[model samples]
Target: MTDHTPHTNHDSNRPAPDQPRASRRGVMKAIGAGAAAATLGIAGISPAAATPDVSLPTDEFVETDGTEFVIDGEPVYFNGANNFWITDDDANAATEERVDAVFDLFDELGINLVRIWAHGEAKEGELVLQPEPGVYNEAALEHHDYVIEAARERGMKLIVALVDNWDHEGGMLQYAEWADAESRYEFYTMDETREMYRNHVETILTRENSYSGLEWRDDPTIAMWELANEPRLEQDDVPNDMDDLEPPEHQEILGEWIQEMSAYIKDLDDNHLVSTGSEGHYYGHWEDDYPDDDWDGQDYLEHHSYDTIDAASFHLYPDHWGDNPADPDDRLSLHDGADYITERVEDAHNELGIPAYLGEFNVNLYDHDLETRNEFLEEWYDAADAVDCNAVIPWQVVLEDTQDHDGFQLYASDSGSIIEDYAEVVAEKSGDWDGDNGNGDEETIAVGEYNTTDTTSDGLHNDFTGDGETTHDDVTAFFENLEDDGVQDNPEAFDFAENDELGFTDVVELLRQV
Candidate 1:
């Protein structure tokens, strides 16, 4: 497929366009497997049939059990990525082929979960899923249906974010603009705008898929419903640092909105989990009404507000959030960022007693080497693992074909790519913590004999190209084994890498130690 120049006025906040739309032939080819399965009555099989009696529950609902997510009555953990643009009209038009390609890559990387946008603001001359207040776009909704259907076919789950807090996609500010309100915070207080938002949520929850003949509320593929993407009441009109009033007076408004929206979603779809995508910010000393240093932290304020919210969601952007190294000239390291995330995870688990989600996080490639970024991710993952955080979804998973405007893209074809290694580790670690095994021990594979011509050796010692010693030749053979057999088959052999999972990092570290 050939690349096309993106529309010059395309929203800068959105991801770059995906590879030119897949051809009709490609679409049919991708769908052929699903079609064939359906013909054989094998598609969309019931959850019970897919899992063994002893396995974790595979039902439609995702519930919480004290800082852990329970699915099918068993605690579960996942590693996910945000692909917000998948449902955007400007990119792949949410076509089956494009969706299939994206899921295909995810499946290859052992990524069983994804987070996508369910709402796009109405804007003139732009692709807005909701073109106006109280209006529905059937075509855009159909695209979303395709997304759910595609995810089902791949055995993957989705986190569907209902709205954006930013104006880039017709968020709260847009709604306020429509209602002629003085500030975006009015979206919570104004009856008219509040009703409009409720109506939109109803439309989404009650939506019926044209292709699958199933209502969205009944679909098991949807892991959870996010009220909004990083919602905050502090916009330009109602900035966070205002004087004359309490520094964080907007907490009440934000809290009310989350409570209302969360209750509405729960009432509509009691089967699914719901969350407020807050950034997990803590109030400053002056902002807190009490003289005590730690009185009324944001985590305590926002997380404790709504009984209906199932989990606490937060984002981590060390560089963007100014949590980087003291010296600007020095490349940003993941060490400090990892500590910040660890603190947040500990607070959410120990303080709030709710399953915490690192919903959005990433380090820009321009500021750090790929190795450093990988190390940063490793630290964050380790922190989450220690605290038993429910899920960790990085900022994004851009495909190889897409043009990367920022260094956040994790998918690359390069042999030594750390992102590739990170994905493998995530895949492995996700399965290790089902809560069924109290020890949190991962399943290990007996390293098969490496056959030089039918090479015969076991463990990491199966160096096909060399005499008994592990050398650079073994590194070459290791990657070859990955291509042929995959990391799951010899996790111990692959454990040489960082992040506690087996991958290229092991090979790099092996060479370094020798």
Candidate 2:
């Protein structure tokens, strides 16, 4: 069912009256005593804080207009990088220096968001496998603390995942062993099993102490809680029950898990938004037998649209480990594909009438061609705006280990710069940066201009192409035509050429074969 709550709202956690110094000390003392910040209200806030409020809805980053994720009463445009595989089972493999550097650089790139995965083991503290005892340190908690504080300090939001369910992963195996050495985790279907997961999440949500004396439940920079990562079956698992559970029981079971946990999260921490980890378009726990499953209470409807996968959705590269689609150019284009996904996003928005998000999309920066990569992102953003997507969180941001042949970063180093850049971009496209974060005054300027025909058209919707053209007359004409006698329903039919993907020779050619 659709959430009837007003979508527009101000962040409730925004300190009213900006508490005095002595009051800050009292809040700190209470926190030190292990008091739940969710109970204290403004009396609990420090002089300067970015924590999520578990008590009030507007106190966090999750205020919505019954339709999309909103920030400070305005619709949010999440523009950030991703960091999924950063914290592996082995802490040695988890480059701390690189992680710090990555956060530093993210600030430089004008980014305002970072998506990190909390693998199953990372969540349960069991994944790390190593030579010695504790050698494989599941530094998930520590790393999460670091990212939360770092992102907040830099004015960037964090989309943190709670579980990773791709391979025969760590946490799942541990849980299975806990149930019975032979059973493959009974919780996959049991109600008690789902409740256990919910309880664990609730514990985290209610906790007031996590990162360096910081409380997660009230952190504004902490965007949303992800339920799990790509909870889907792999190629080798097709023959096994992993592809789709037998008797079609697990589909309903898993959907219930999502719904339960989603509700649990919303109830526990009304301030922050919550989402299931991005699920694959096909053969996923969410898609299997319940092909007709469609629920709407969750804040974000996340999907991982890659290039491959026999069912539906876009393609994912490098992992295209098979001999299909043998054309080299087709493969490369698919690797950097975006327009196709954009069109899909457009359709989803038009059809679903909900806030959709691209949870994770990435390529090895050092290996992928720069021009193609840039093109993909440009196309993705264009389509996102066209459809009013809630957010686009790319994978693996700011890790020092990350490198490009050209020596660049997916993240910026100066946090303020990135925040400013994002604020500017969002402001330029829409009006303001949702001012409650103390981001400053709203600037008024018509977003995109149009005309009956092309006359002095400048680059209004031409951001992705960077062709330097979005003028008044063209925009005016485009919208005018959209409102014409016969064109009432599908305003998307307007021919704003520069923003028109079908007419763009390069884009058309890119999608021609795919």
Error of 1 at 333 (Å): 7.1
Please give, for residues 171-243, the per-residue lDDT of candidate 2 as tens digits.
4434444444322235454444455556567645654545657467777767777766554322222223344
Task: For model 2, give the 10-residue run with minimal summed lDDT.
Answer: 304-313
lDDT per model, in order?
Answer: 0.60, 0.42
Off by over 4 Å in 1: 1-59, 91-93, 124-127, 239-245, 286-301, 323-334, 414-514
Candidate 2 accuracy as lDDT: 0.42
* lDDT of each residue in 1-514, candidate 1, tens digit only: 0011232332222243322322223223233222322322332221121110011222345677787876655566766778765676574434456677777656545465789888877754234578888887787888889888777765567899888877667788788777887566577778988988898889988999987877888887788898888776542344245432343556666777788889989888888889887676665565342211222224444554468987888787666655354344333335565665677777777877777888888777778777777766777777777666678788777556655556675663531233334444443333322332112122333333453311112234333442323334444455445544645654655565446676545544444322
